[model samples]
Target: MAKQKTAFVCSDCGSDYVKWQGQCGDCHAWNTLKEIRLGPAKGSGRAGASVADQRKGFAGALDSARVLKEIDLDAVPRISSGAGEFDRVLGGGLVSGSAILIGGNPGAGKSTLLLQTMCHLAKSMDALYVTGEESLQQIAMRAKRLGLPTDALRLMAETNVEAIVAAVDELKPRVLVIDSIQVVHTDELTSAPGSVSQVRECAAYLIRYAKQSGTVLLLVGHVTKDGSLAGPKVLEHMIDCSILLEGSEDARFRILRGQKNRFGAVNELGVFAMTEQGMREVKNPSAIFLDRGSEPASGSAVMVVWEGTRPLLVEVQALVDDSQLGNPRRVAVGLEQNRLAMLLAILHRHGGLQVGDQDVFANVVGGVKVLETSADLALLLAIVSSFRDRVLPTDLVVFGEVGLSGEIRPVPNGQERLSEAVKHGFKWAIVPKGNAPRADIKGMRVTAVAKLSEALAALE
Candidate 1:
């Protein structure tokens, strides 16, 4: 008979403990320890578990199990999901037998993305979509509303894990997508569906089955109230990649970011606009960002921001005004708030700008937010130029990270930034004094300034 013992395990990090305590020693999370069935009781401490007794069940099976070395890897070619942005996030389309985990907020269009992907993949290959949270009729209705083709795409409405895996084996589908993993459960675990144990086990089994059968699996996961994977943390580790979807509450534009990817670039971001025609990819994003009819005004500057290998030109707008309130308010949207505050302080102290009694609001024109620090200098210049009531030259482009001492700092890939500016027909680029590349671009001149004082002087 197998011996049973008691042990304490952390509910969060899976750390083990000898004694039950209110606080976990490893992760410092409170009340995370729960009693678990352990191995041997007393003398099994030093060697962890006695190998003498360890020679037991599954040993014969383990010795005989052999891994496949000549599996067919190129049997199924990747099916491109129509959208370029979506394809980039997926690392050059879907792999043959890869498993993907997608999570996001409610109504954030997790279903929309996969549904569209299925429709696109169905054009070339047979794709199966299994949904635990919705019925086949409901899925069909949504597909019709989204104008997606349904002839090649198959839909299965089942929640039982056994039945799901059996269907996949029989169908030999090219790609399998699970709408949400939280609702699927197996009979082996006593815990209910969506519980930590059930989720982890379900994901593990599905991943193993996908790998063995050579079916690309896409698992749609739910996010918790705290914006984390709804189930245990280990659920993320069992899969090959994770994609995160972020959107505003009002739903004007949505951002797709790669949280983890083993196949492609990590810095790539996909931009999509929510429209009546459906989620359309904005290929030329900069054109959509510029103001259409507004006159060229003071405090607004055009600068180039790099997103991965692509250079995106944006219009940075700032409104600086005198304040009647004792504490002047400074607000920033689509950029770092603390960094804006720091830039304002530096402008006041070193650049001799009177911003303390000014009410300022800065915006990145479009709904897209800036993540790269290279936009810092452009933003700072826009705010200063706006406060001084000076209209920046339309042919000028500025980008750099500013230091606390009011010095313009160099950012990565300066050459690419300049090349992009030159291609866009910008005659002048104000960059860091020493770091500007001497790379030649016809009809464009690069101006490198060392300090903000020098930049303000040149701009004026």
Candidate 2:
């Protein structure tokens, strides 16, 4: 037998260390190191039965490289999950043999979404949902409650990775849904399930099975306190797609975001509303984020933000108050706090707004997170409105990148933004001078401004 080696692994960031330490060297996390024993890998010259060496099924095949010209020109077809919103985030549909990792907070409905999709996928293909966390009867109850077609879908409640792989070979399923990789463990590994070693090893086995068998693997994952996918950081690189399902637990709305995709566009958003039945797709997402008030309100501005290829009209709201504390608080929800500070500085210096002593708060309505700078102008306008107690035009929409020097910079897809604003009955638009689209939008009147002072002046 080969000599067994022991190593310490950080549970928080999956960094391997030679010895025990109070703090992890890589993640700087304290008290996260755990000791684990490692045996020689499978297919080794000295092994009796290697951990993952048995390649009795499709994984045993090997192929040589072929010439580029010899490859067929046929296009691969994507399988639609019968859910438009899910398909939208997946760049049309799910590709065969692709491995997707989905992470979300507890009660974020990761299981519900996958269960619904698997039911839909079972209509045409052989779909199997293996649950390591929940019982088969519990899944059946959920399927009944969600009004899903359960007859076509198969369910298995097993946590053993070796058993799961053996079942995959016996079933030969095209679509495989693993409730979570964290709970599944291999008997060969002495560490408990959800350990870093267990997660990496189990995921590797499943990924190899999916790639060799041409099966689409959907993995449900847990999120850390920082909202990143749990387990080793390399787990994200091994999969073809990485997704996050996020929203407030109290709110009925949920946002499915694609953080990484090899076959599709990254940072794509899909909107869904929770109901008694199940998750329903939101077709007109612009209406969900925009406030439809007849009269204009102070500290509120409209912004046309691009999510993937779709344009969404979202409301930017800000509140300014006199602070009694030594350092005024700058709080932002759904918007970056650092960006708010920079915008406030620009407003005070260039636009001549007195906001240094006031406490500022900014928010993007309807639980939609805005990460781009295209909504900077609208956010600043909302801050100014709250500070000066002024109400801007309700029908007007604004979008432009605000620089540190208070310059209004042009954003991408200017025409799409303007057209979306017009489609939603907006009469006025304040855009960057450089972003004046070539084609004119009929209903909305566009005013191009180059400087921050010009944009503030137009609010009068």
Candidate 3:
């Protein structure tokens, strides 16, 4: 007989501890340690029984490896779903035998996007959608409401992992979509579905099946409150690609960002707009993110930021007001709080703006998040414009990284940013001194500044 033991596991990092604690030692997440009862050790009498049950639907055998030169390069061709933005994020199209994990907040349109993709792909290739969360009738209703044809598509509503795998083996679909990996369970595991062990094991079986059968597998996952994919962190590492569908709940715009991709580039983003028909690709995101034909208002500035291979012009807005409370508040949306604080300090020390005692709030328009430092200068300028109550030129676009000593640092792809700005009818641009255009951009003027003070003076 094997001895059973209790272990405390951190939900964020999957690190197991001997005792329960308030904070996870590895991930530093507070109140995340959950106590779980472990079964007997591996290799015990029950081990073989559980392992054999879990391996029932998994494909068997491993082929011998071949030399790099002898391997065929064109065995697998990428499959296109006819969605431009979606294909762009995938680095062309979906690859055979590749496992993709996409997670997002509830109602962020994960199911809607996947269903649309399945509908499109079903027209050309054999596509199967297995929904554990919703029934076939519900899915059909949604498809009908979205005006999608369900003739070529096959839908199965099953939550048992083993049954789903059996169906996949029998059907042999070119593309398979699991509505959510969290809702599926296997009888081999005593733990419930969505548990760390069950999620990890179930995904392993499905991924193995995909590899052996050359089927493209798309796994939809749930996300935690912190906007990270739920389940064990190992779940992310087990897949070929990890994608995040990001957008505000009330906003129509959705950003499909690739966090990890084995066959393509990482950090690539595809912009989409949720419409009455379905999710529509935004070919020109600049026009959506930037407000045009309005008078230039205080605390508003245009910034040219790069998302993957594309450059977008978005408006950054800030507000500075007298603090009625004892401690002044620093609020930021679509921008990091720490980053905003650092920029405010640089503004006061370098740009000679006093705003520490006042309440500061900043946001990026169109529900877009600014993660890069290229928007630092524009954010500072917006805050400065609000503090001074001065209106900046509506046609001006600014982009550069602001350093601790108030130096404006050059950003990558300076020429591309300027070109994008010019295309959007921006007449003037403020860039880092060293970031001169490789070629002259037509219909635009470039004013390079090395210091934050120079950038602020350019507003005069």
Candidate 4:
């Protein structure tokens, strides 16, 4: 028998090291190094086999180099995931020979969404569902409870990578789903499942098989406490697309956003509502996020944000209260804290609103996270309204970036945003001067502001 070999690997960055250290040189994460045992070398027993035979499970073929212009550029058709919202986030549809990683918190309905999709796709194509975390009985029970057609879809409960690949070779499935890569292990490595070495190797082998076989691979991944995919960072790079399912525990809605996509645009958003039946796609997502009461309230302002190819209208809420402590508290939910501090300073400097001694709290309604600068003006307006105990008009919509010099900056896709707001019956809009439409839009009044002071005056 060949002697076993061991090496230290960083859990955070997947960096290999000859010896264990306190800190990883690449990622600088402290105490993340873990020992792993490697398998024997290839061709250990078969001495006469060629190099190609020894690397049977590896993906790809030997081909002669060709000129870039001479290579054919035929477009490959995409497979529909059976859910319109899901397909939208995937840049229209799922591409063959692609590896997609989807992660989310527990009870976020990651499994439910994929099961529903596979059941629908299996009606027309050969699809396989492999579960490493759940049992075959549990899956069948869920499907039966959800009233999914169980006749066509193939199911397997296995965790060994080699066995799964062997079954795939025999079945020749056009689409395959590994219900999480963490629990799946391989015979090549002695490390336990979910370890850095195991996840990295198993994903590589499966991705290789998918690429060579032209199979659509959907991988369900677990999220860390911080809501990021739980595995080696390289797992993200090896896949064709990386998406995340986001929703709070108490919230019934889930948002699927693509963080990385090689075939389509990134930052695309998809909305779904968890029902007793299963996951239902929300056609009008903006309505759900903008579901406020009939009466207008203080500290609330509406804003239009561009999400991928569409515009989303969401509400921004703020609370400003007198601080009893020497140091006032600043809290921001579903928005960046540092940006809130910066916006507060701009409000004081440019808008002449002094609330430094007050406790400021900001929140984006419906649990939607706003990462763009278009929410700057809306957030400042909400803060000012709350400070003055004034209620803004319910028909008003606001969007613009506030600069350090108090000038309002324009955001991309301005016309589309205003049109979306208008379609939703927003009669008034406060936008940057550059975003103002050349032709006046019917049923809507536009207030184009050049500076922060001008935006504040528009409120009066």
Candidate 5:
């Protein structure tokens, strides 16, 4: 019998070391290394020859090296995920022999979404749904409660990766879902389930099987407190696409954003609303996000922001009040805090609006995060409107990137943004001079600004 080997693996970065240490050399994280025991050496009688041979060429394909130009350019067909919003985030649809990782916080409906999708997809293709965290009865009950078609989808409650692969080999399903990678374990490693070693090995074995079988693999993952996937950082790199399901428990809306994608565009957003009938796709997300009151208040402004290939019109709100603390509070929700401070400085220096002694609060309505710089002009204008107790026109829209020297910079997809705003009945727009349309846009009045002072004057 071969002696059991042991190694220390970093829980944070998944770097392995021969011996234990206080800090991980790779991630530089303190006290993250944990000991993991290997079962045995391959082909050493303990692991057996069959297991060793299987790992030799897990992909099950061997070909001679060829020139890049000789490679086939035929597009691979995509499998529809049954949900339009879900399919939108996945480029067009799910790709065969591809691994997709979806992570979310607990009770964020990771299992619910997969169950809903699998039930619909099983009607057309051979699909298997494996549950490591829930029982078979529980899944069936939920499906029935959601009024889903329960006759077609195959269900299995298994945690062992080897057993799952064995079942997959016999069933030959077109789609396979593991809910989730954290609970699955492999027989080759002695580490507990959800450990770094267990997750790494189990995902590798399953992914290899999926690739060899030309099956679509969907893995549900858990997120850390900070909303990032909880696993070895390399786990993200191993998958073809990585998506995050974000929403609080109290909120009915959930946002699925693609953090990584090989088949589709990154940063693609999919909106869904939770209801009694499972997850319902929000086709016109812009409408739901822009549902405002009849009366437009001061400090409230509308902005056209680009999301992936489409344009989104969201509201930007600001509040400027007297500060009780010695250091004035600068708070921003769903927007960068540091950027708000910088924009305030520019407003004071160029726009001649001073709010340094007052507390400034900024928020993007509808829980949509504004990462693009196009919200710079809108945010600054919202703050100024709040300080002056002025109400901007409800039909007006704003978008531009503000530079340090107070110059308004043009943003990408300016034409698309204007068109979307026009569709929503916005009759006026404040944009950078570079983004101004050469031709008239019919009913929309375009106000082009080159500097911060010019933008401030437009508000008057």
Candidate 6:
């Protein structure tokens, strides 16, 4: 006979926890202990309900455990998102039987991208969008705003997983899109919608159906006040791919960032600017973010911020002014605060700049929040330029990091950054001290900057 069945669940990883504790042994999320259900000890747990588990007792009796078996490695035909930025972020688009969990703050355009993608697929394949978060009339209004085709796209507003699956069985959709999975619950789970148990149960059923039937499932998830996925942590592990739609509250630009991809690259980002018609693709982002027609102004410099494999040239602006009060202020936006402090010290000591008694304010134009340390050189140069009240050359781009000793550090894939700059019509590139150009892109002059002093001298 099977052991007693229990609903032990971990507050941290959502892994079943039979006993209570101060900390979650798995995943190490502190203070994340909760007894989701009453269950017996681990030895009395019921067997997992799968065919694979039934073979547990036949391992030795079965023909020699196949040590090495041929496996299928080739990827299936993929569906590309109409937007290049979006497609690249999803590692060249959606794979068959993939359950993608996308979580973001309110107004992050999660629904916009998902619906548009479904509409795009509905043109060729059968697609069904089940929205537990929005009513049919609401979705129709939004579809009208999106200029969607009435016949190709199908919508069902349901919150029950059993009913949703039945509709899927009837529709036999090639692609299924669920907007805000937190709203959908299961009949088996007594927990309410958006709760830990409900989200966990609903996600498990959808994931199981997708894997068994090879249907591409797209899920829109919610974010808690702390900006984490609103469901149990295990919900993230159950999905094959996870993306976070991040941006401002007003939604000027949206960043589609991938956290986990069974088939593609990680940390890939796609930038999209919100418009009246819909989310518009920014083909030439550098031109829009970086000032093109501006004269070389001191206290401003351009940088090649690496977003995954792609290099984007962004403008870094710094302002250094004499501290009117005894204590100076340090302010940075779209940049790390700790690194700014380090760079300031470097400028004051190694570069012989008098910034200690001055207030500094730094920003990356166009609302881009860059995390690359490669922005170091540009930041330092911008500080110097701002102090000198001069601007950098309008035709130039800066690429490199700054060391404590005031030496220029080379960034990864410098060649890619250079080519992108050249394609964007940048003429002069101030790179690391000893870096060599990978290819001579015509119309662009490369300048090797060894130190903070050397770069300032060249600009002067």
- Native-to-model Cα distance after best TM-score fit, residue 356 in candidate 5, in Å: 1.1
lDDT of 2 by residue, 1-460 (tens): 8777778887766788888899999889898887777764333335475534443333433556699998763545798988898998988888887899989998888899999999988988899999999999999999999899988999999999889989989999999999899999999888889887888778877887787778899999999888887887768877899999998689899999999998888889999988877888999989878855677778999999988878889998999999999999999999988888888889989999988789999989998899999999999999989998999888899999998888999999998889888888999999999888777778878999999999999888
Cα distance off (Å), candidate 2, residue 18:
4.8
- Residues 1-460 of candidate 3 have per-residue lDDT tens digits of 8676778777788888899889988889998776666653222345347755444343433446679998887997889967888888888899998899999999989999999999999998899999998989999999999999889999999988889989998988999999899998877678888987678768887888887778999999999888888887877877999999998789889999999998888888889999988899988888988854456689999998888777889999999999998989999998999999998888888888888799999999988888899999999989988988998888899999999999999999898899888888899999998897866778988999999999988888
In model 5, the runs with Cα more than 4 Å from the true position are 1-9, 14-21, 24-28, 35-60, 73-75
Better of 3 and 5 by TM-score: 5
1 or 2, greater by TM-score: 2
Higher-TM-score candidate of 1 and 6: 6
Q: Put down candidate 5 lDDT per residue, 1-460, tens digits, no spaces.
A: 8777888878777788899999888879998887777654222344346654445444434456799998865656889988999999999999988899999988878889999999999999999999999999999999999999999999999999889999999999999999999999977777789887888778877887777678999999999987767877768867899999988888899988889999999899999999999899999998988898888799999999887778999999999999999999999999999999999999999999889899999999888888899999999999999999999899999999999999999999999999999999999999999999989998899999999999999877
Candidate lDDT values, in order: 0.78, 0.87, 0.87, 0.91, 0.89, 0.79
Give the candidate number with the greatest lDDT: 4
Model 2, position 224, has a per-residue lDDT of 88
Local accuracy of candidate 1 as per-residue lDDT tens digits, 1-460: 8555656666577676778999988789898676644333222234566664343221111134456886565665666778998878878887766788989888777888888888888888788899988888888888888787888998998887778898998898888999889999877666688876567667776776776666889999988686777776666666777988878568777777777777777656788887665678877666666543457778888778877557778888899998989988878988888888998898888899878888989998776678888888888889988888888988889988888988888887788878777776789989886657766568888889888888888886
User: What is candidate 2's local distance difference test score?
Assistant: 0.87
List model 6 lDDT by residue over 263-303, tens digit each: 78887778888876678778767777876443555677788
Candidate order (TM-score): 4, 5, 2, 3, 6, 1
Position 177, candidate 4: lDDT: 95
Off by over 4 Å in 6: 1-18, 21-30, 38-75, 291-297, 324-327, 438-441
Q: Count backbone overlaps in model 4.
A: 0
